[model samples]
Target: MSETDRPRPRRRRPFRKAVGLAVLLAVIGYFLVQRASNSGPAYCTASATGAGTAGAGTVQTYEMTHEQAANAATIAAVGISKGLPDRAVTIALATAMQESALRNLDHGDRDSLGLFQQRPSQGWGTPQQIMDPVYSAGIFYDRLAEIKGYTRLPLTVAAQKVQLSGFPQAYAKHEPDAAVLTAAFGENGIPASLACSGPAPAAGDPEKVRAELARAFGKEAREALGAGRAGAAAGRSKPAGTVSEAEVGLRLKEGGGPAEARRGRAMAHWAVARSKELGIVRVSYDGSSWVAGRDGGAWRGKGGEGGRKGGAGDPHDAAPGEVRIFVARATAH
Candidate 1:
């Protein structure tokens, strides 16, 4: 062929470089978005003193989104209501992280669904029921309880029995974070260990908050949140569902000693975990308080240090072993 007519070598290098640059930028953008989604919007943390668990004077903390924290608190509360102990909460949480990253998903492998990916074909529950985090967590605990000495079993082994995941070892990797979250939600968890901060939504649902509390914590919650409110209302009691938008009080049984105290605190943490959803602006338990949009949502001790104005419903308003939840008003702009 004539030199001029000969086919010129294809210019591949420039094409390859352009493609490489696009791929690199795409990867970088993906990671930046993931980081923002994880750390932005709202966040919650569970911190434990390492004096015995890790090391003296060292603090170990696990941070997760407000959604993860709320789901975790529900798991812990349901387990506690069932008298299932903290180990059960840890196992349930690790399994959820492995299966759905602690999100109550509507779809999963085969008929699997919800937090633990329980399948309806395996008799876990209907999709609608399993989609309820409380229901899914309860079902998981029921199955876990049937296993002999499940509390003593290795975390992965116990979770595998419930999940039967293809990758049994995947559950192990989440155990550390799960355990930290469990410690924050359990009765013996560090005081004020669980707190959440998210954008102040325009409004919140007090009835939904009451309903969720009752469902997660069982009849005890009903009595504390319902009967207590009724008694306080005197002759002007309204229907149970008519909780005020601006406030919800959880008067845990007047007294049961230290365990009762911790239970109240755990409930308080639950309120904080769900602050963004329930429109909980402030939560006070024992003496410490947590206020969303303030102090990075950290819990504060008495004396208004948490940024609450001295007024009718201050954080210190809560009596011993009592928890007060102040919600967002419907009129909030």
Candidate 2:
């Protein structure tokens, strides 16, 4: 073909540029979706023995939101602090699950309220007191304790005597899920065994964390939390150049003993469950650590522990039974 008659080469540069731009936008959109997914609702699960039942055996998981897990944890913790056995914690958890699905609701069937749906007219307590998970749990445990050989009684029988729910058999179904949670939030549960896919909080309050800890776990928790604050004050791990004023170092104990170690695990899991509400950014106990927004706050080894220069303190730097909790402090305006 003559040179003049030859068709000019189609301009591919603009086409290529447009394609590249579209690809870039798609990539950005993918990341945005991923970020949104990561920050979505908080979820926790445990494998029940017979598939979604607590114990040991099957791979089935019982799932619940951060709120439910927190309530259930509190129920179990109260029972434990009162020197009740694991069985007691399990019964309480299952009963709470059946009555309120582990929620601290302000209302229920026929003036019922709170975790166990205790009614005001029934002499359980006033509506205000019933709404308090701690009080409700304590009262429930008290009633459960009164049942002669309650632990030896059938799960439904035990819970029914205390709850007196119309659907006493309902407690049977939650037993598996309760068992899973009991195994996790209970002292017998593994360290960092439970996880919640909560996004990093906008800000955190160290004081609130301490108050909640004291409220849930009582005096020992308060003392251990104080020790952690002291450590942060004395220049523990952080992101360099910045102070750890917003960090809390809860030394579960000076060293590991069986009770202390188990307690540490329970405390660590509690922080994880309450991470969403407490503005917890990270939780570290023993050689493992969990950072909010990372793999849904899944526990990871100390590989990320190094090179932490101190802005918030390295969570993995916990000594012995220590648990480090970090909050995203509000930046000075």
Candidate 3:
């Protein structure tokens, strides 16, 4: 009886091992599926078809959207950062990073718009204007900058000053998230290829716009930069209308000089500042366009001014995007 019972007991051991192995394999399979299905929010992973691929040089679709949000965050942060104490950038980034995750959302606690969730009803601006990421961010910074001793103030108080939310303390909860977004979005923090889906400018006919940009950039400016594409339909006309430093940067980044890029950034900021007053619809420089697209919301342009296909005379003025910075300097001068 003892031998029979002992002999029979051995069968359960192998069965138990097999069951354990199956469970282990299943667990590994589950995690593998999860990783393949979705890359975490902090960063998006590339797919087999290379969808949403963002890296230092790549600008994936998600990264681009995130970059747009980051740019909006930077716009707001830089506005508040000027002449303010060190913590101002931190507080501003933190607030925006948390609120809209720097995405300039259309909806919020109640009819809020853009990065800071500024309410049109509160006299911030019109819905269309407030929804403009740069404009909304500018307004937020303007108000925040006006707050005396804001840097010394508690984070909650500083944010409340600009936001005036019903729950003043709520901004504190966002501080951590804001930090993460800030780090992720900061200069080269995320990959250059990190991109998101947004509105693209008019695609059909660029000839008229290019001609305008070429006319605006001036022959001397075009020659100095070695711009190609002398007779393309969308040559240089479009960029001339509103050349932001970004347009300049596109040219420089493509191989424009240091003087060009520096001047370009200064102008882009200046042009963006004057967006409301000028009735200016678009500003392009540095291979990018900040203007109204067929769909809307921070549309960027391509080719045209950033390229060098124009004629020898270089009939464009100010290199298109230099106006914004040039104007600021002019005012100060």
lDDT of 1 by residue, 46-131 (tens): 87664124554566678888788889888888988887777888888888888888788888788888888888889988889999
Residue-level lDDT tens digits of model 2 in 201-309: 6666888887887887787787787776442333344564432436777876665466666567778888888888878777777777777777545676665432233
Q: lDDT of model 1 at residue 21?
A: 100
Best candidate, lDDT: 1
lDDT of each: 0.75, 0.73, 0.44
Error of 1 at 225 (Å): 1.0
TM-score ranking, high to low:
1, 2, 3
The clash tally of candidate 1 reads 0
Q: Candidate 3 local accuracy as lDDT?
A: 0.44
Q: What are the candidates' C-alpha RMSDs?
A: 8.0, 8.8, 13.3
TM-score of 3: 0.42
Give the range where candidate 3 is weakest over 10 consecutive residues by summed lDDT: 324-333
Tell how far residue 302 is off in model 2, in angstroms. Answer: 1.7
C-alpha positional error of residue 258 in candidate 2 after TM-score superposition, expressed in Å: 3.3
Residue 180 miss distance in model 3 (angstroms): 5.9
Off by over 4 Å in 1: 1-40, 51-53, 189-192, 227-245, 305-316, 331-333
Task: Give, for candidate 1, the lowest lDDT window spanning 10 residues.
Answer: 228-237
